[model samples]
Target: MNNEITDSGVATGLAKILADVAGRLAAAPLSARDPLHVPAVATADARVRGMVLRGVDTTRWTLRFHTDSRAPKARIIETQSAVGVLFYDREARVQIRCQGTGAVVRDGAEVDAAWEAATAFARRCYLGLAPGAVTGRPSSGLPDWVEGVRPTEEQLLPARRNFAILSVTVDEIDWFTLAHTGHRRAVFRRDDGWRGEWIAP
Candidate 1:
């Protein structure tokens, strides 16, 4: 936490920070090698989980991820849309705190469009018996047919029962950078066409 500070310099600094993180996200397919891959997502209940970086829509200032329809995350989003998304670029010592509202799109146009755009590799996760299922075994609980490979599009059509899109509409962003000399922190809000301020770190 820090004191109130606002200036053009703060705005520019914030943009550069955001752009840096956005650039890392743009290099997606989200591999372990990527600077930013798994982001921490928090629900209204304070449940925090890590999810892959699905896609970043700068045009709409939204972030997308796919999850099981029956998962708690989906129901949480349905009731309380407020969510917190965190992205960290360890090498750069930068962390982004995204404050947004999330919506679970199941069979709607948005989900249909996103499902179509999802690569076979990405869509493979949903082709399972159930998400977060408990079995006596220590595995994903997916059957052999849909395991270890991308199911054919025909095989995947039925997987829609579990597939859902998590769309987060970002409204506020807090960015921080750590340096040897000191630290910098800034916040940007969408209200009134984007306003930002710098605060002591």
Candidate 2:
């Protein structure tokens, strides 16, 4: 009997598991970068008190998200740059957790590039009055400044003042999968490389 688990077998198994988890995450329509994209995001607002944002796997694993400058979450990032993002897919029975430190980037070529990529509707997210302001029941739609009409280039300039981009540099990722017969877990940490271990289901 071949007691040794071939590296190919291990790789294949991990690939299949990752693909299944990715499918589940895609089906859930959760933003890989924004935990708020998940339905349960609001429920944990009090405890977590921040948005679950993901980063792109680029040179620095740049994690970008838009928020109003006045939102409390911005302050949270300022005080505490370290944060975690959690992703769970019920159908696939998988969870992905990412940890990293965040920073706000404003007024630069990068900011301009990100802003250019945003759609007009997304830009509208920043047009409202100071974020987190309490408001009574609206008798009508949002104000003209924010919704009554499209913003011009000049208007967008000031709007950029309120827009903020958050970048997260990933330090580690923990991936887990649950199955009827068994469970799988892997932790990938920067600088330390990768480690895999199996646990009882």
Candidate 3:
């Protein structure tokens, strides 16, 4: 982790750091290779899973993730709400920890748009068994016929029912970076209007 830290002049301002985070997240959804594209999302019950970063709503201070409505975490999030998302970019040696409340939107404008935006192959996951089902054997959970194949619109009809969006309204963010000279950390809260404050790392 320390090896990635370079002597490049680090921005010591809270606003700059916040802007950097926003920019990285804004680009995450467009590129699968982005380090922040798949972040570890944890529910209130301590279950954590890597979820694809679907969209970011900066105005609403929300992060959107696509998930199956039948997934265990989806049900947990609907009831518990409290959740955490961790993002780390090794090359930048930065870590962003976000705490928020989540909501599972099964049938809404956002869900419909996300579903429509996904490719036929990408949407195939929802056509499988619910995540975490006991298959009693190693499995991708996807049906055998759809393996390595994209389903047609008619074949994908049922998948829309299982598809849902996990939207998290971020309340707080803790950003940390490791450096050779010294480490930097900052905390930002929505209640404070995102006027971030630096903290000792």
- Candidate 2 at 153: error in angstroms? 1.9
Q: Mind giving the per-residue lDDT tens digits that candidate 2 earns over 1-201? A: 011212454755654544443344343324444332442211112335445342243345445656677777667777767766676766557677767786777778877787888877667667677765766766233356556677776666667788777766656656887877777786545553333333333
lDDT per residue as tens, model 3, 74-163: 889878999999999999999999999999999978788989999998889889999889999999899999999989999999999999
Candidate 3 TM-score versus the reference: 0.89
Query: Which segments of candidate 1 are over 4 A away from where they belong?
Result: 1-11, 28-32, 119-124, 148-150
Alpha carbon lDDT of each predicted model: 0.78, 0.57, 0.86
Candidate 2 local accuracy as lDDT? 0.57
- Compared with the true structure, the alpha-carbon lDDT of candidate 3 equals 0.86
For 1-201, candidate 1 gives per-residue lDDT tens digits of 121225656655666656665566666535767766788999999999998777888767788888888898898889999999988888889888899999888888878887888888677777765766777788776778777877889988877778888889888888889998998887877754556778787
* Weakest lDDT window of 10 consecutive positions for candidate 1: 1-10
lDDT of 3 at 186: 82
Best by TM-score: 3
Q: Candidate order by lDDT, highest to lowest?
A: 3, 1, 2
TM-score for each prediction? 0.83, 0.70, 0.89
